[model samples]
Target chain A: MANGIIEKVKEQATSVWEKVHGSQVAESILRPGSPFKKGYSDTPRNRSYVIMNNVLYHLHPVKVKRHGVRLSYTLCLGGISFFLFILLTITGIFLMFYYAPTAEAAYSDVAALSTSVAFGSLVRNMHRWGAHFMVLSVFLHMSRVFYHGAYKPPREFNWVVGVILLLLTLLLSFTGYLLPWDQLALWAVTVGTNMAGFVPVFGGQVKFLLLGSVEVTADTILRWYVLHVLFFPFIIVIFMAVHFWRVRKDGGISGPL
Target chain B: MSDIPEHLLRRSAEAKAKALGIPVEDVLAEMTGEAAPTPMDIGEQPKVETVVAPDPATPAAVPVAEPETPSQEPTPPAPVMAASSADAGDVDYDAAATKAGMPASLLKRSVEAKAKASGASPASVLAEMLGEEVPAAPPAASAPPPAEPAPVEEITESVAEVVEIPIVEPAAAASVAAEPPAASRSGGATAVAARPLAQPEAVPEGVRTQRLLTVVKANAIQQVKSEPTDKVNTWPHLMIMEFAALLAVTAVLIVLSVILQAPLLESANFNATPNPSKAPWYFLGLQELLSYFDPQIAGVTVPTIIGLVGFMAIPYVDRNPSTKPSDRKFAIFMYTFFMMGAATLTIFGVLFRGPGFNFTYPWADGIFFDDLKDWVNF
Candidate 1:
């Protein structure tokens, strides 16, 4: 059995090597001590060195000389945003254990959370404020970058992507804003969606897409509840990663003019 | 490229040609073949050239006269020639002069004097060489008649001696071989160039505020003069300031959160409806707008559209230099105006709009009918 497993592994490695490098090249490259090596140098001063040299270094550079400390903690607006996401993930998971999506139980589960769960208010407030903080910080962060002229030259395109992400973030906030569905929430959403009706071109289509109907009824609530809980967050996270990648690619908020 | 001489280009081209396996002879032949015709081709076809075999008989007659004439006459002859050309110059040597154009004539006299010494006119003369049209003149003014202005012009000739002797660079000296008249013309005006204009180079009054801290020393000025650090560098200071602000806000929020515990409003009552519904304050702006307009336009559409549009428009509108307050004036204005307007409108709506058409609600009907409809119906 061991021999068979070893043979299988060898066959897979050969196949992988062939795919990455055609047979002749792979055969020559795989030959040991061919002089040239791939990837970062292992000795030091590069990524591998950074990883091997310091024990606490696995987190990547906390503060790059360029992207800054706020960006480092991801606690600046994006960080606060990412933190809220983490808090939401945690609180959301716990909330999920007790809560049912069904209209019958969803409100009851939330009530139970307030009355029964220890630190549930803390979790709930943290999540709530986290969402708020995420929105506020993200906007603040975008404004900071804008004022800094960080959006010029190589970063111009990224700024456009950032603006898109900002819209996504507002969507996340709006969809989440309706989840509790009290009179305040219902009416607030009613007020919110009513505003969506003014979109010069996309107004009706967007309203329909959002509420699933002409009014904020049960269908509207369920749709938003799903989007708030699931869809928008997933989409935002992918975009958030892309936004950070672009920031790094853009050479870290081009300082001043 | 840092002033490397032509040989380096030649050597590099040769090296490149060799490396490329191109024949050097073919390259050299091509380069030279294209070059040889250029001098004869581009140099003007001189109307007066090929004088080399200048009439053999004329040369013999000229030298025969050269031995007889006084050498002093040769020196004076060059001066006479220069005066004729330079008199026709910008100075107007004024075959006459008014007090105003005196700089021009004295200028010509001085140029004439220098030509008597130098033997050739300068190759080039600038506009100002005609002497400054300034009001100073002891020369032609003293000459009784324009014809006898020759004496004043002569004095200028002598005066040209007192200046302009030491410029000895040979290649530059060649430029003046034909430049003696220009020198005489230039001589009168060197003083006029002394235009004591106000100096922008003078230190600014702002320097009074420029004193360096004792700890920073002279280096502070030098440092700032070159590449001063922006506020971002004072990271510790910013941290302290941010924390101080955060602490103050935290204290206030905690006090408020404790003293006026945020009501955990009755959980999700779908049936027993709250009489007056309200959103979180951050959103009251949108909720408030609902009162002023239709639900579709005011509530659902406008806020979403505004939020998206405002977010998108930020980069376009805020084209300031940097994050500094001095930069981005419009950005600051628009942001402040929008936020304030939104906040104010929202607050006014929540505080005064009074339950948003409350009389239309089921419970408000009895109060509505008794007070409002009773008058209308009666």
Candidate 2:
């Protein structure tokens, strides 16, 4: 009886919807077709459906055959790296709230974040270590994917994205270096950015822009700060989206050997 | 019709329509056509007209309209199952069929075939054989089907339509989930199902235990992903990417530390300052221009503007993978070399050696700013 009432209500609601929005909505709601196909659950929509439906689902293979080393393969290293990147982003933002880019007090801000604020030291260390770990994991992820032949065929562009991400990781580190504004920070940035001076035609201009004029000073520190904290991160995120989208488009990672 | 059960007989006309995969009216129209030819042969197209019911005083008459539905050729049903049944079951079939190599159809066929071959009714054979244990076997499922041939088509179609759990060919996309350093292949569908599946891998005695251990072992392993092997192209391969990276990072720290020993002093306290009070080496390029423009403009304003633009533009300039270092080696190399030279020149001018004022080597300093007037502009 309840089902009958609900069915009647559904019929009425459908007609009402059709009246308001036309029959397309009604047709779509009642289409007789399967939403998915075989061998292609790696599509972005399906992946998210799986992830949101079952969080641990991504951790396991679609088919689990009993092999000698099945467990080792099921928990991917890339997933770990992706998780750590998330950790770093969170901690980095927290640290940012306390850090100032000016040479006058950037060092003290770090020192205070380490010793003064509540759990500040832990947050800073975690951010610092998270950065380190993410770099390591991402590197390991690339190697694992390569050895497994995952970078073949459809996954090629994602490899390129990974490489770009690697560069961005290094850049993030380099930009953060100057936030401390100590002699060590200044010289380190100087040496790092100096590598840019090798460009053929626009080398000098690139150098001037990075240094803010001719050298590492307050301007350079501020530049590195914004780039590290804001610019590079924003860019890296966009690239990451494309990378993941490509992974889905390319039919997921290469399967077993 | 009299022998059929009431529920079976009452199978709704709606159910019949659904099962036949045709509209109720269409079936009626077809039956009518066969029973008595229509004056117009019902024309080609069946026009789908919506029925608008008026008040109870008058009933709307049902009428069949003709409309041309595109002709769809009958396609054979694919032999396959839904990837994972979100439908129903508590099937012990897999366990029963494991040793038998049997498909389900064959299980249904066994008694029938045995009865026919032995000249006994299938029910009579089952009644007499009830007490004897017929080990649930799979091979028997396939044995009886070949001679009949009809079931082969059914199995073939099911095989095509079966929705596999692993959407990607299992062998094709397994590594996506392989926790780095270990490739645990728990065949069948998942680790959860592998417990039962592992029983067969034990044909080699301890093989089952080992497979279980491998699947269990992946839990504890430290899965470090983002391996840099393929990225060896970005960095020189000779250093062994990781080692080179480690070395490069260490070199960077060392080089920076060495350069910091003689950091340029801030111009804010320059009166009693040492001979060269330049900005940091990283700031040298800007300091070189301070010699020309006012401190407010060259020292603060210009650098500020450039820094804002540089950072803000990064996402726009290198938004995609096509601009990666591996794809644009020369561009990366140039980016590196040019930035480095400029940094060095700027540092050298501000702290150690300048075009004017102080007299020190940029590396060791006595350097101070010299005017274009005080020294050669070039």
Candidate 3:
């Protein structure tokens, strides 16, 4: 009786799977060369189509030099940096749900994540570490490109764009460092901004503009929050788009050397 | 025919007359049939003499001369006649057939049928069929006997028809030969005699005689700037490795997150400042520089001028084209030196500096950095 019941359940599950996968909706969603698309066979033509027909084609060409694919050649540092940015964004959004950008709530809200919220501390930890990793990866990626002399000739402008991206990543990481509104966040930002106040003539104005006042306050938290979550992200994304495009246009990742 | 502008027709007639080495009036008169065909000697015309193959076995080789004069209208019978003279032994028939996308047997059969009908060798016919220039004929005197007069008349007729027709479809021309119009039965009969004995079945629409517009040598048109490099598809090759990297990074991040809790200290108390307040780890290197120099030089000038602008200028300033490590020793050395210096400064700021920002060993001072407070206990 149990065996018959199990067989019936198995048959029903198979039918449901077939119904969903074979539906027109599913077919429409899975593009022509998508691996998940029904009846997708591995062929040379299909391999080309897989990139050509997908959005990833925007970032990567249909083919790259064989050496470009090797792990040691690039160390995949650039790709890892991009992936870390995405991971941070995901974890950042989750943290935002429980966070408030006010001095009164920010510290307690962060502390509560470790005690009350489910996976909140874990996600927060990921966001923090991921941001650090992104900074490290972007720096390493720049170093790798320099070591390959990939910045020469047509790639010179792309290297400039890369430097700008690195600056933006640092700014994003620095701004987020203050969101917790703790003693560490407060003093760390104070020391950092004190240096900004040392800028020659317009130092005072720059410091005021950055802190949203003479010093870090509730207003500074809100300002940094918006910059961290929205403004910098928007600017960085545009730069990343141009960077990825120029990589392909400048004839892809530099050399075997 | 009346719809064609007179000057355009006259210009075309002039071009044809020049090609055929005859008067424009003669060509115009021949087109209107207002006079008898010009009795031009075939031997005097270089084009005609060049096409007159000495090998009697390749009688159909005559039409191979038509494609030489760019101004002349394409003769519908040329491909047929050319296919018939496929006896040119130099061409690899199997390779040509494969390139042309047809079975070798089918190509051979077509060549044989055309050859039998026109009394031409199959080798020369195949060569012409493959769009290769037929080897220059010996002379007009040694030209094949059977099709000698036929080529001259065919040339004049094709030249006369040039101004009236913009394009001639081969299938339509074949049909015209099969059922000649009442007015042109003699010309149609000559075409029919030269036609291939067995027409290829179901010839795809794209398979038509290609006309050469110009002959720009490969070097003149294509500038090969770079050598073809070894390449692999991004899908399974690059993408698979990329996926592995992504997964590996994610696993590491998750494991790190599980083990290490990100620090959150007491709420901000502006009145009671923490001693030795330091910036984020990334900025610690700059702060370390602050201890050695004026704040303006270390903080503002160094970060802006030397750090950001200087790094951006590396490629432009270096001017060294070679990427080889051995060749770029100076560039590599400077970068490595800068990296090591910054790393040392950052480490000193993070671990050595204690209360009142004074230098102190982390082991002796019980570690002042709050971010790492949880990881290291006194």
Candidate 4:
């Protein structure tokens, strides 16, 4: 049986080599000692080619106006806001490892995370501050765009997309505010959602939908924890993709008008 | 600016007025003054060429001079020749500008200056260069007197300097040479160009075109003293800038988070509602508003309207084409007022509102920090 297995493996290796060597060009490039460099030539044309070939880099225009990236003009507020979102996502995931969404365990889990888990406090701190900073930066970005009149003309639709994003940011922050299952989180969310309850026809229903009950219960904690860590983040990602894509389509960050 | 047309100025004024339910002339008067400045100019290309180029005889055909001149003294003869050539061929300003390695807005302005220097109506010159019929006579009043023409000696000196330098790359000259007649044909018919006396009859159109192309090329070389719109590539410049900003933001956030722990009070107890339950800082504005009006109005109706009208409807309603803040005085005033009110209300909610959500100064008991400590120390 061992001899037969060895022969079969040798046959497979031979076939693979035959396939590889059948194409002379592939054989030359894929050979163990081949001198081929993976990157394109360093010419300006090839530099553009590199951008076009890459998936991530292609989102950026090969050339951008200097004003679009000016520190004073944009303050890179949008970029910083996005970076904070990424930081929150990472830290939030780390927090989840030590967290329990259930009301019976949620607050205790947080206590345990802070007391037992290494770097737990640091991660949590980063996430909290990142959330607040994201909100602040997004607000400032909107103001920047408005003051610069960057929302005019072709960028009008992008501005609306941006507004939706602003709403998303607030929603994300609000939902996450309740995850700690502490008095501040609980009362703050209750008061904040109560505002939503003031909606004309669907106020009570909306509140019920959000809290998963009439008040902040185990279900409410679980639902908010899920929304904060997963659902809202997922939705925000979708909206963010559309937002970034639309910004590019609307001629990259609006400059002047 | 050669880039912002007078018609646009008028249209923006009209739109603002109509939106505000005021007279168009009033809007015009309000927007026309200090709002027009080159300081922090956005450099949008003139839309006038598209609108006015199509009909040569239209009253809008009056070719205005360049609005902002380069701070650096430009070579007089170069732009004069460039403008004349641009007019002669109905040069596709956008394409030619690209070929000359300058932005279209700046090129348009430069061309206008050139036209003004040559004592020609830019549109008519373009029409003539394209071999189109010129308007019978542009009323003398239409032509503004030349603001300042470089002295003949200075102009010649500059012309000599330009010719000797050969500053423009050969590739750019070749590209410029190729674009003219094709672009000129589409430039719209208006008038024939009065041939420059310096033109040699023996020279072919292509050769003359080459010389004119050189003029534009030279202007671009000279204009390099001015800031360029797209100076650096986005990859390194934008990406690096964004990364640096992220690092800075992270550093600030780290310090803040480390210095002040986020508040996490005792596990939620519905039976023990805090005396003045408050929302997050962002919602403080709405919460403050709730004190003034019914919850339905402050929380629901007003926010919804502001969202729909202030953000969504702004582009459609405001419609003032000028992006400058000075020009957008009324819009700015409204925005400022709304922002200030929201900020004031938020401050009141976050700081001043005390026990039982009653209005109280932050320092009602003592110093502001002592009161703040009472809340935090709890």
Q: What is the DockQ of each candidate?
A: 0.10, 0.02, 0.60, 0.38
Per-candidate iRMSD: 6.7, 13.6, 0.6, 2.2
Whole-model lDDT per candidate: 0.48, 0.46, 0.77, 0.64
Write down the worst ten-residue block by lDDT for model 4 chain A. Answer: A31-40
- Candidate with the larger DockQ of 3 and 4: 3
> lDDT per residue, candidate 2, A119-191, as tens digits?
6766665665456566666666765554454555556567767777766776676676567665445554565
lDDT of 2: 0.46
Each model's fnat?
A: 0.21, 0.00, 0.88, 0.71
Encode model 3's per-residue lDDT on A1-257: one tens digit a residue.
99999999999999999899889999989888888887889998899989999998898899999889989989999999999999999999899999989988999999999999999888998999899899999999999998888999889999999999999999999999999999999999999999999999999999999999998888999999999999999999999999999999998988778
| After superposition, candidate 4 runs with Cα above 4 Å error | A1-43, A46-50, B1-231, B366-378
Error of 4 at B232 (Å): 2.3
Tell me the docking grade of candidate 4.
acceptable
Q: Which parts of model 3 are misplaced by more than 4 Å?
A: A1-20, B1-224
TM-score of chain B of 1: 0.31
Task: Give per-residue CA lDDT, model 1, range A51-151, as digits (tens).
Answer: 23444233333224333544332225544455556656776676667666555565566667667987555555555555556667667777666556677
Q: How does candidate 2 fare on TM-score?
A: 0.36
Tens digits of per-residue lDDT, candidate 1, B76-107, equal 01112223444344434443244334565565
Q: Pick the candidate with the highest TM-score.
A: 3
Error of 1 at B156 (Å): 62
User: For candidate 4, lDDT tens digit of each residue in B263-341?
Assistant: 6678878888876788888888898899889999998987888954567778778788778988998988887788789
Candidate 4, residues A1-257: lDDT per residue as tens digits? Answer: 99999999999998897676656677555433222323334565654544454564636777777667778888888888888999998888899888888877888888776789997877887888788788888988988888888888888877887888888898899888888887777777888888889999889999899999987777888888778877888888888898889888877766554
Docking class for candidate 2? incorrect
